[model samples]
Target: MPTDASNFSVTMVIRSILYTTQQASESPYNYVPTEWVCIFFLTAYSISTAIHMGQALRYKLWWMIPTVTFAGILEIFGWSCRLWSSQSPELLRPFEMQLFGTILAPTPLVAAYFIIFGRITIHFGPQFSRLTPNMYIIVFFSLDTICLTIQAVGSVFAAEAVNEYKSPTLGGNIMLGGISAQLFAIWVYLGLAAEFFLRRKYNAPFRRQVIKFGKGQRSMSKDVQCMIYALGFCTICIIIRSVYRTVELADGWSGTVISTESYFNWLDGGFVVVAMYTLNVIHPGIYLKSVDTSLPDEDKVNLSYVF
Candidate 1:
């Protein structure tokens, strides 16, 4: 019905339109999809940590269980909030989740450290160590409580002033500082605990002779090794998170750091969740009970060796 030239021109117009539309669809902004893989892994890790911590509680490892549970719950909420963010990047609700989650998660870690040292004193005679066990608990945990309180207050203030003063920056800094302090304390405490344990192990001839008689006594060494490894991993993870947060916050509210929420999700959610779940695997419920019974009452009460 139409001339050949007319038909050819019409076909060319249609093809051009289609090609333009396809190009727009393939633009970088449109093609860059959110990372759902990270979300799934974080979710799985958090759930598993929570379940394992719940099981740990049944064994009456009260100090260890509560801290692990608290950390796991915060992580679950954080990851869930992250999922919501991935679905609707414009809503901005997940910022609260990230804010509160990071602030609340580390409190339980500090508390766990306190419990470990406290229990150690109870197991080993407090007199065996240069410092009293109760003093160590009071000093370190008191500092930790103060740090947590400050960080919590900062978070609340930051949340109220969201996007105004970049409150999360200040709050996150306080939290990072608190966690850094906690990590430092852990290292110090670990050194002190280890020194005490080794001193007692080699110096106490009577106990050494007694422990050699029973094959089960080797379990004590294994338990101590497990605890050291778990605590070490926890410290490293917290330090990593703290460093990441500190750098992210250094640029303030207007920086690309806060705007790029996805980056935060990976560092905060991915690394922290994995580290926490690892700690669950070595929970005191499994190791402590098996080895604790082997120690004499005096050894058990020695606070230096308990953790």
Candidate 2:
């Protein structure tokens, strides 16, 4: 409900705005009435994202929530921009908003998961990892950051092309490069995670150490498993979204997939929204409360997670 006269007037102004463009230069063709859908996504994502932040503060899952929260907030902003695009497609601002915001949004989620993986390996025993636990954050996250910058700058270039009324192939290629790089990083991370999990599950070395130390140590705690599940679930969701974006961008701005609003909702918006909500419901803080103290005192990679 609109609160005041000014609000009502602004609403009317937005509704009245419409974009007119020729076929050759027009990038995003309006496929559906995106105004309401964008708003719905924005609202849902905000609640879940905010809840994650609140959960972190309440339960002291400090390292976990920041990146997810940031990602969620960014998605909300991106969708709001989508609404702006719905109202005025000819305007560069709205396209720019959704383009850059959505592209950069998941990078933080990647960071969150990358950080959690290090912590997870540390808790499980860093010796199980092929690369040191420290490298998890330093290597993968550095890639994520670099990939994010490339994607962001590329999106900016693509969005800004509306000013000249000419599409730029270079911008699209840069964005694709960024997306492909990020996807490559994710695949590498997944490979590392899989190898470590397999080694811990079956390898004779880690098994002998566990046996030498204690039998019960072989079975991970229920909470620890939940933490793994949450991280894995979120990561899979990011991977799904990244894959969709990669394919969509391959068609370039004028491609059928990029122009399709339903695809955006189903793939881009759906994946992240589901992930944030899923993680919120799973609640990492609940699973990881006692995890920090459980690390081996000698090789313990110290991470400040206040319980």
Candidate 3:
């Protein structure tokens, strides 16, 4: 009887220890366990985005290829970090993974946005608007860069604080705010781009005529429609992620955020990643003029013969 009692006591102690460790490791802010779910979605997203990016490269869509590639890589890395966190939630390194991923991933999306805006201006004729295509790219991307820089700096600061004091500090808040501002900028930019496209489409009699041609017109409209859809979807995904992040960090690591890991997974990993991969399915290259035939006949023949 004494032997059985001793074994039971030992088992209880071990279980208690495990439970305490788990509780300690859990994010104080979250109410649900979602690390595994986040990892799964992010991993899937990364793979899909990578595949699409490869397709973009295959078509020589130079501007978009790099952006998609960057986003894919960052997402994979970020998810890997999340996975690591799930394994050992007490470790601070996982936070660094998330920080880098969050900071770098959005840059490509911003770049993609710039390209779309530039294309719209060119399509409509730059003279029709006060802003030049190049100016739009320069101004918006510059602002994006600034926001990224601030978020990065804030993340680094937060990491440093965590490492030194074993707690998150004001840096996290700063980073959160920076990301929120970026989200705002993205929405504003999207609104402007949508307005520009609508106005331009409305004014273009040739495009309007082409649309009235029925089945054949579908091919002509596909590219423009895809571009608009991709941009709008990306903007919405980013905005949702940003809002979640703001809420997550609102308490500045004091643990007020609910469903942290799961929310990040669904909003950031799943949605953003899926939206990015969608770009590959409807790549602008499919609609843009063929690169091989861009040159004059003489040049094309010479180039083909040389190859």
Candidate 4:
């Protein structure tokens, strides 16, 4: 491996050469991520998506297909781009592709997590919830959409940035803002979920009725139990991912932590991948049976990728 200075100087020379030749300008720096790590995540997320697809189709989970499908696609494709950059570090295209794709990939996955809460609440009877089950899907997901769009737009701007020549601060700040918004949204959603569970656990309205209704869940079924566990685990996993993004982005786009591939794989990629697989194994679609199609249109996917 060449020294950092040599690597940078070579990149500068290449950029200058491209400029003189009137060729498309490229980023002067190459990330050069480890190939094995990229392959590992790509393969894992792909298999997870395939399994989730089978389960979704088996249970007719139309609402979840968009969220699950897009996340898997984005993660797999983003990692593939990383593989490209590792092989040919001088090319700028792969870096641009991975930048926004990987960052925006988890947005839909987090939406899936938010949807699970609403469904679980409905299963247990929304009356025990501090807010209606509908509220969870409507409010939190709207916030999710905002966060997703902001981050995506910010990434686009960042990708257009010329390394060592242009400032990425504007785009970086927008991305950071989106991440901040997501952190707030998920934390609030978690608080609501915790409140609902506690309210049901303690002496609250419908406490006695809810207990007698299902004989403490014998009537509600095992799927309900599974949904509870799945939701809890998924929340924790995604929270770790969001926190990682927030901290990593705060350090600036080219900060040491963000520049380190291993750390990112462990925190961002690892956290979301575990959550996706865990959700697949404990699939709510397997147990949810049938949701009311008559429920507000916003709750269903209906071709909306972000919601």
Candidate 5:
């Protein structure tokens, strides 16, 4: 039989081997993230952020400046972390930073969209909207705040669990709840958007109101129309991204959705890239003018007034 000291040494060697094996087996990203892909995203976000800052400054789009800039910066940071993670896939810090940064980045961007839609409603006429222009911002932004909080807290727990080399089921579930709530809010917002458009198209009195920068009764300016179309496209892309994230988290950390990097590259990263660039091409600052504040609000129908 081995002496006690030798036995202890043997046991320590076995434990060391097992610990290394566990570390090797537990990758935050099941597959190593592609380096080139991460670089592409990082570069793209950096350029877009520069463009957004210039536009916001030029047009004095004070409301959009912070939200869009913040989103772009977060995206840049996240992608940079991803690039670092690709190099050091075994490291926990990069994974934690990328995961938290990417997940939370879009929240501000989505808030910017809400504000855009609210401004659009005001531009067309708030009376045509079901919940009024301001209510759209109020209701959706409040829900967004709640969801953001949930997601932030959940991400911390998930990161801790990952550090401890345990299953992130509880944290994942919490994140799912938050993301699911966000999805529901997006759907409802779409419904309200539909209602606003339908009301504007079919409502007789509003149709007769003098159209802005257009000759015909129902015609909107080409710029406004383009802005509206761009907003719609962005909304669709965001929906796709949100759905992808929701499903990814729902399938647990070790599941197929998270295991495959392609789904994330396309559904999550691709969609957002498309959306951000689409906005850059058809920028709201250039296409969408300020709401005509001179117009009377006597006919406005707010949710507060209804209740």
Candidate 6:
């Protein structure tokens, strides 16, 4: 039903969009991604995921089945997409796959950490915690899910804008806001967790258990200490990664931080690798095995707290 002039105008608009992609100056990533690096991460994630699955099954840690295992799978998929993108830098599909996979992968890992903290709260004694074990899981998990949704929605808008040759400012701001919120949430969680320990340290009325170690001391088990340490370490790693991501996103897609593979390799991918491997070495399932077995079925510290 369009006249010839209208059809010509439509053609011109399409041509303009197409022309943007063909420009040498334009690329989703400013530089071609390194193939070997992508493969390395993919292989590492594959191994880590395999180990997590085996540990979860052997320990019957059904709660972790959905959290840690799922997170590793996401990392694998994301790196695989990165590997594909290295081969075809011009393709948007692979870039998007990697972008989303990497962005959302950490969410489950963070959730798993939250669940573990809840269990720790129970193991020590619910009396020391300001929030109930169930509430800890519920409140933080909800915050994490909300943050993830915001990032995802923002990514979709940004991608669409890129495809249309439009400025991605609005979408980028949304993403920045989401990641920033996530960073703030992590800090708050750390604060609460630290407060829990401090309460036990000072509040004599609430101090039911004292963890002692080293010099012929008799108190909390070694594995429990290790588990707590591992949780803290993994959390630190997540914080580092989160901070880096916030900065990278803030700089925008064309920003130097996003353009350089080295920064991402070390700050983003490197931190995640360390966290995942650290979990493998000090797995909650193995370390917390005694807690699970010692507690009565009804009193077990697991995801049943969710319901």
For each candidate, the alpha-carbon lDDT, in order, equals: 0.60, 0.77, 0.64, 0.74, 0.79, 0.80
* Lowest lDDT block of 10, candidate 3: 210-219
- Residue-level lDDT tens digits of model 3 in 107-129: 67767767766765544334333
TM-score of each: 0.69, 0.83, 0.76, 0.79, 0.83, 0.83
Q: List the residue pairs that clash in candidate 4.
A: none
Give the TM-score (vs. native) of candidate 5: 0.83
User: Model 4: what TM-score?
Assistant: 0.79
Candidate 1, residues 1-307, lDDT tens digits: the string is 8999999999999999886556434421121224475467566766776666676667877655567677777766766665665554444456555567765676676567566655554454343454566767777777777766766776666665664534455665665566566656666776776666666566532122212222322323567567757866776676676666656656565566654646665676666766666666776666556556766665544323222
Residues 1-307, model 4: lDDT tens digits = 7999999999999998776334212322324567788888889988998988888788877767788767878888888887787666667678778877888888888888878778777656465676666778888888989999999999888778734347777887889999899988888887878887777767464322322322243134666677778778878887788788888878876677776667788988898899889878788776565334323454343311111
> RMSD in angstroms, candidate 1?
7.7
**Stretches > 4 Å off in candidate 4:** 1-30, 206-220, 290-307
Q: List, residue by residue over 219-251, the lDDT tens digit for candidate 6.
A: 347898899899999999989999998899889
Candidate that beats the other on lDDT, 1 or 4, i.e. the better one: 4
Of the two candidates 2 and 5, the one with more favorable lDDT, higher being better, is 5
Count clashes in each candidate, considering only residues at least 3 apart in sequence or on different chains.
Answer: 12, 0, 0, 0, 0, 0
Q: Which candidate is the best by lDDT?
A: 6
lDDT score, residue 73, model 5?
88
Candidate 3 TM-score to native: 0.76
Worst 10 residues of 1 by lDDT: 205-214
Residues 100-205, candidate 5, lDDT per residue (tens digit)?
8788777777888888889787656555677766877899988988988888888888888888988778888888888888888888998988888887788632
In candidate 5, which residue pairs get closer than 3 Å at backbone N, Cα or C atoms, i.e. clash? none
Please write out the lDDT profile of model 2 over residues 1-307, one tens digit for every residue: 6679989888777665532334213435544336788889989988988798888799877775658888888898898887877666656677777888888899988888888788777667555667677889999989988998999889878877855667856787899899899989999999989888987787523322322322333457898898888888888888889899999889876788887778889888998898888778876677766676664564342432211
